[model samples]
Target: MTDGKVKARLKWACRRGMLELDVLFIPFVNEAYDDLSEQDKLTFERLLTCQDPELFAWFMGHEACEDTELNAMVQFILGRVKV
Candidate 1:
């Protein structure tokens, strides 16, 4: 299969994961990251698919975005909400 095909599949899977992110996450976004019960946020971060500015924003309150963007997001969120 072509690179485009692989990328498309990845995007689709990421979208599906986004649904999970919303279901499992949205409620905790506005809360201070440090205030969260550590394990819950760690679990969400581990399971989340679209990890990106969108997710970070969603955590802070923004749009949901792509699959691989998660690593940067993990960093951003941790950095932004550090203790």
Candidate 2:
């Protein structure tokens, strides 16, 4: 797929039931997603598959993601937003 298509799909996937997640994800996909390596991009996609509550915990620093890759991605996003 084209890069725009990929980003468009990712932007859609970034939308969540939670507003907190939306603020984090939409901006990340818009401002940062293009800069990611292919591997990291895939990892981001994998992160999207995760449940919202788990993602919330991870993002909020209340819990850690057991998957190192996912954790890294989570941290990376948090770091970017300083949240």
Candidate 3:
């Protein structure tokens, strides 16, 4: 897909129904996604496909990802928000 289309799709996917997930995801998509390596970009897309409760657990630091790729992506997103 074109970069514009990819971004638009990502923006739509990032809108999790839950406020907490939305708050975390939308900012990262807007501010950081374009700078990620191609692999990381794909990983982030995969992360978005995961169920919301699972995502919430990871982002809340209450659960950990067994997949290293996903673990790293979660950390990458967390890093951006940790001022």
Candidate 4:
């Protein structure tokens, strides 16, 4: 797929059933995804595969991922929304 198609797909994946996840993901994909390294892009894609409850736990500070790549991606998303 072309880069544009990949981005379109990622954008679709960003639209979670949960409003809170939507708020965090959609803007990040639009604004920050282009700036991510190839590996970080993969990491974010991996993160998108995780369950909503696990994502909520990590993003909300209830828990941290043992996988460093996943943790970093979680932090990357969280960093964008912190005041």
Candidate 5:
């Protein structure tokens, strides 16, 4: 329920999705993301946990700030993404 917690979760979630997300889209999404309410971020984070369909939903702009689990599997992905 805290923004800091959500941000931490989201940072992890972001790395997990690895997503093949467009680097170009980062600034745009980050800006829009900054303007979003925290609840929106949590929701989007949830949606992020799924496979391509849910990921595509965010990419396609159908979902914003969906809630997705940021677990050990995600952390593993985050580790790979870090390098």
Candidate 6:
């Protein structure tokens, strides 16, 4: 897929019922997605596949993601935003 198409899809995927998530994800995709290594981009996509509640907990530091890779990705995202 083209970069534009991939970004479009990622933007759509970033939309969540929770405003907090939307704020984090939408901007990350817009500003940072293109800069990601291909593997990290894939990891981001994998992060998206997680359930919202799980994502919320992880992002909010209520719980840690059990999968080390996913947890690292979560920390990466949070670090980007300094959250």
For model 4, what is the alpha-carbon lDDT of residue 53? 93
Which residue pairs in candidate 4 have backbone atoms (N, alpha carbon, C) closer than 3 angstroms, thus clashing?
Answer: none
Which scores better on lDDT, 1 or 4?
A: 4
Q: Write the per-residue lDDT of candidate 6 for residues 1-83, one digit (tens) a residue.
A: 99889999999999998998999999999888889999899999999988899999999999999999899889988999985
TM-score for each predicted model, relative to the true structure: 0.24, 0.96, 0.96, 0.95, 0.42, 0.95
Candidate 3 lDDT over residue span 1-83, tens digit each: 89999999999999997999999999998999999999999999999999999999999999999899999999988888997
Q: Which stretches of candidate 6 lie above 4 Å from their native place? A: none
All candidates in order of TM-score, best leading: 3, 2, 6, 4, 5, 1
Prediction 4 global C-alpha lDDT: 0.91
lDDT, candidate 1, 1-83, per-residue tens:
67466334434434434453443344334444336455644544454544444564655544443434444454455564454
Give model 6 RMSD, 1 decimal.
1.1
Candidate that would win on lDDT:
2
Q: Residue pairs in steric clash, candidate 1?
A: 51-69, 51-70, 57-62, 58-62
Please identify model 4 stretches exceeding 4 Å from their true place: none
Tens digit per residue, CA lDDT, model 5, 33-60: 5565666555445545567654555554
Q: In model 5, what is the error at residue 68, expressed in angstroms?
A: 17
- Mark the regions of model 1 whose C-alpha exceeds 4 Å error after superposition: 17-83
| Candidate 6 or 3, higher TM-score | 3
Q: How should the candidates be ordered by lDDT, best one leading? A: 2, 3, 6, 4, 5, 1
lDDT of 6: 0.92
Cα lDDT tens digits, model 2, 49-73, are 9999999999998999999999999
> What's the lDDT of the predicted structure labeled candidate 3?
0.93
Runs of candidate 3 with Cα error greater than 4 angstroms are none
Instruction: Return model 5's CA RMSD, one decimal.
Output: 10.8
State the weakest 10-residue window (summed lDDT) of model 6.
74-83
lDDT of model 3 at residue 8? Answer: 95
Candidate 4 local lDDT, 1-83, one digit each (tens): 99999999999999988888999999999999999999999999999999999988888899999999999888878877885
